[model samples]
Target: MKRPGIMIKDVFKRLTMKPVTSKYPAEKSPAEPGYRGKMEFYVDKCISCGMCAKDCPSFACVMEEIDGKKRPVFYLDKCMFCAQCEESCPKDAIKMTTEYELAHLAGNPQIVK
Candidate 1:
């Protein structure tokens, strides 16, 4: 192991570098490729296969029977933002969007068809 002076030098070097923090809300940050932020569902394209709910690792996805068709209900509070549901959808109905601003006052469930 190196001396403690080496660690101090590393810290000083980082301090001299430009800050990497983003000004969120005031300025939007670009998401990296394949970054999973939010989930969106295309209702008409969905076949009600229930694959998305079954494949969700966080148990955030649920298939509900609404009206005459089965719809997907996503609990964002319980989601890990893994985008597993998007990959499991056979009909290409589910998608992971770049929308990461999911803060809500009432915290309601997202009903996607």
Candidate 2:
């Protein structure tokens, strides 16, 4: 009973203490070891390979044409965040990073051509 009250007061005081904030958007914080952030497309490394698209269980990924060039367009809305795309990439062009803050105005990943 007494410890709970003391603990409550300590927590309140700590909340107003020195601020521990990370510079988001400008500076990214350290993600966990297995963090899954937005998937990055290293087209240079990619050999126009369709392994990631074919292996995706959800079929959420799409390879589209971009100015006569074929590129991968991933639909985040349909994605399951299973990291299958990353694993399927032989060139390691795609990876899952720990970036939980993936907010977009469109609500869809318009990476396709």
Candidate 3:
């Protein structure tokens, strides 16, 4: 029903236009506000209540004995980044940072001491 030349015209128009996607690896994108990417643990504010470990869905948070005191160890390999630990911390010991580059070759967990 449409003219055959219309399809050709549309294709040519698209070909002359600039690309919309950015060069990712060569160029870093700015993170937006309130973006939850990574987790940061504050040992000074922690109370050893173990609430962060208890509410963690992925079991990424675990209380370990550190220098005769119980401390939280975070395993980023298994973490879902759901911010459950941040929400459950009554002492504001846990916080989320805008750091998403977590690629690693080592088979060890990222223990936050």
Candidate 4:
């Protein structure tokens, strides 16, 4: 139980304070450097080494046979985006981009093939 005078003083202090939240949808903020958001896979750069799939902590990356060669398939829904796959790639095929708006409807798989 707080005193009425103390409560009133606290209320006045809070009312004068500036808002701590950002205008998200109305004003987009750029992602900082080294902020891992989405992944971009380059087929031409990939050497079919399967190291990216093997190093993924969330098991989001799967090695699939495509055009007679093994390629890494990214399941964005299952991915934690820790950038382990990007670090493990020797050919620099997998790179992380800062585009974070990845919302999609349920049951639709966000697969990067």
Query: What lDDT would each prediction earn against the true structure?
Result: 0.82, 0.76, 0.87, 0.91
What would the per-residue lDDT of candidate 2 be over residues 1-113, giving only the tens digit for each residue?
A: 44456588779999889878867769877777877766777777877778888988888887887777776778876777898988988899887767667567774554422
Best-matching candidate per lDDT: 4
- The alpha-carbon RMSD values of the candidates against the true structure, listed in the order shown, are 3.2, 4.6, 2.3, 3.1
Worst 10-residue lDDT window for candidate 1 reads: 104-113
TM-score of each: 0.74, 0.63, 0.82, 0.80
| Candidate with the larger lDDT of 1 and 2 | 1
Greater TM-score among 1 and 4 belongs to 4
- The local distance difference test score of model 1 is 0.82
> Which parts of model 2 have CA positions greater than 4 angstroms off?
1-31, 106-113
Q: Write the per-residue lDDT of candidate 3 for residues 14-101, one digit (tens) a residue.
A: 8999987889879997677788888888888989999988999999889998998898899888899999999988999999999888
Q: For residues 28-64, could you state the per-residue lDDT of candidate 4 as single tens digits?
A: 8789987898899999999999999899989999999
lDDT string for model 1 (1-113, tens) is 75567688779989999988878869888788777888887888988899988998988899898888987888888899888888888889988888777787774655444
Candidate 3: segments with Cα more than 4 A from true spot: 1-17
lDDT of 1 at 79: 92
